[model samples]
Target: MVTAAIGGERPVRDIVPGDHLCLTFADDAEQRPVVTEYLSAGLSRGERVLCFVDRTTPGIVLDWLASTGVDTGAALLGGRLRLVPAADSYLASGRFDAAAMVGTVRREVDASLAEGFSGLRICGEMSWAVRESVGTAELARYEREVDAVFAGRPVSAVCQYDARLFGPDQLEVLDGCHRGSVEPPPLRGHDSLRLVPAGRAGRRRLRVIGTVDDRTHDHFVAALDAVLHRPGDVVLDLSALDFIDVAGLRALANAAARLGGHRRMRLAHPAPVLCEVVRLLGWDRTPGLVLLPEGDVA
Candidate 1:
């Protein structure tokens, strides 16, 4: 039930342990926000993150991350964040050796788990491979072979390729080698679902932002399903939600019915409109549901 950030605030549940994904970007500017948000999600979930920087320097990466509100200094000093130069990591012997690099990453994942971290999240810049003229055949072989590295390990990685540098054929091969690809940026003015880790114990919070309606209830249902699958209590935060349609309300009511008998689901900070609807429908009296007030606004 692990999730990762794909389109900034949007969560992608397809990402899980032992998974490798492909991220194709037109430029660093386009990729910066996605990477920062993705890494921030890992840090918040107490996962160790390793980034291979080739398009930019480690200091620049840290600065960019800080601009996104991540405590870059704290994460780096605490050893939770590891920034490795792309050349040093992918070309340790002054050449691109996929087998060696895979081995190195496997060792790092092991060390991260041994250090008491939940899991490891890795990002590698593949522009260097293209610039270095790492033979297409060799690169393709490397991409295919690397998938085996995550067979049973608690590791998740994204191989970033510059779409402008790679051709259609090569990109197709790369795409096929990955378990999944980073989705396109979500359209503006749409709803977003964020999975926030609740600090108290191993609990989790699903924060719904923007409006949820028939057009977006699928996202809501997916988020709820992800949280409900985990053991223990869950919280749904609607403090930032502006609107919800009847379909969205029905989705929540159905989720409440699926909660474990002993476990409860807390709906916090609902909007004034939602509060009124809940009261009119007597949804507040539903078993396994706790609707909190004070989030209602006139």
Candidate 2:
């Protein structure tokens, strides 16, 4: 049940074992950063990483990792990183089989653990599924089955999808099979604010950095709206938020109230002023609005 913001390395870096993430990109320009960061993070954390390559060669993928300052040679030499060809793995036997693929992943995870690695991290380029031998329904089924394998296991996976190759309908179907999608780009406000989605302990979070006042109120609300659409309780990580006016605080309270049944909007580590306003206005008692103590935001 791990999830992440639509975009950014921070979110990807936060990915823990047992999380299955879907990443969609338009081209190599958009894909390189995310893929490299994900692999680098795993390697840094002592995890054995396996990257299944399609639409590119192993050499090229290695180069991409090297360019990101990764010690590619050392990682490969230590048996901590493997760049596999998709054809020899995912599409082996000349076609895709969901059960076989799931078993393959399970075996990989077990092998990594046996080898004394912290855990297993996988990144699969899924463009090969577009071949004639592969069926859309089978692709979706494989993703769903893989998700089951990842749950509560010492394995984390990211399925990379090329938006230019897959149609919107097919992409939507596949995206729904994973815990969450990693968007290609981050959402930016007009130089005043940035809202990034993140997850921790299976809870969805929106990291709000920068100010939230009259000028940036609309942007903040829009970002909040987008995050609210996600299933489960939402945590607004205002740890880095510089300032927030009363209007912004009210919006959070209102949103929490709207989410009435079991779902809550948690304001994590909000500024002192914001807390005072909530107490002064008696919004602290609002049913779904929770104000977390300073050190508890993370």
Candidate 3:
């Protein structure tokens, strides 16, 4: 199995050969280190690394890698690293063809394995799409095709998008397409949340982080609802979650009531705050909901 690190830590072992990851980063400076770390990790594990550079030129990227103490020269010389222009990758034949790009990606994966690499790791800078008028519909179709191409292949991909360039609607489409997303580290003592998509099965697993209050209620609801739409059970791992406001609590109750009978929801490793809220609301008896103790968390 292939594993990719989210936010420099949090190794997600659930990543299989055909998994596609979506990444939204603040800027090239903030994302360079993370990307370097990811590529470096793959190289260490004997995986072929393919990087598509758009906003950042090859020289700049190579310099960043060198700064990270990675032997970019040796990696290139060894045929373990393949760096190409992002526009070239996305605009093959002077047009963006989702089917063609997906086929090319699959071929690359197969070629990598045939060349003696254990697997293939791909990171594409998606800024080209934004500048080239790649419509939301087109990009979404491309993402879905990429996901399909990954199935049962020794290929792991991270498609990068700029948070500043893409609007919320486009970003949401991007997020919904990938199996998982790479999140940055949480603030030291601030309130925040991170959702990590588990797998492609009907079941969806999310790892919640930090606090959930009125400030984050909308996002919390959106995240929860996103998972509920999946085929089977929805598992919310709340072990790292610190707090939940009344609104957040109501969101959970609403989800439980809405999913009653038709679907199931699992609350794993509920913190003290969550446990108390559920108890106070008598949500322990909520239908179609299961609360697993910390030790029994799935």
Task: Provide TM-scores for the models.
Answer: 0.58, 0.61, 0.60
Error of 3 at 40 (Å): 0.6
The C-alpha stretches of model 2 lying farther than 4 A from their native spots are: 1-10, 187-298
lDDT of each: 0.71, 0.77, 0.72
Which one wins on lDDT? 2
What digit string (tens of lDDT, one per residue) describes model 2 on residues 160-261? 987667765676677778787664445546577998655421333667888988899998888666556445567888888999888988888888888868
Q: Is candidate 1 or candidate 2 better by TM-score?
A: 2
Q: Which clashing pairs does model 1 show?
A: none
Superposed by TM-score, candidate 2 places the C-alpha of residue 43 at a distance from the truth, in angstroms, of 0.4
Model 3, position 138: C-alpha lDDT score: 91
Considering lDDT, which of the candidate structures 1 and 3 is the better prediction for this target?
A: 3
Ordered by lDDT, highest first, the candidates read: 2, 3, 1
lDDT of 1 at 83: 96
Q: Give the per-residue Cα lDDT of candidate 2 at 203.
A: 35
lDDT by residue for model 3 over 203-284, one digit each (tens)?
A: 2256788788867777788877754544445677777777888788778878877885666678888877667778898987
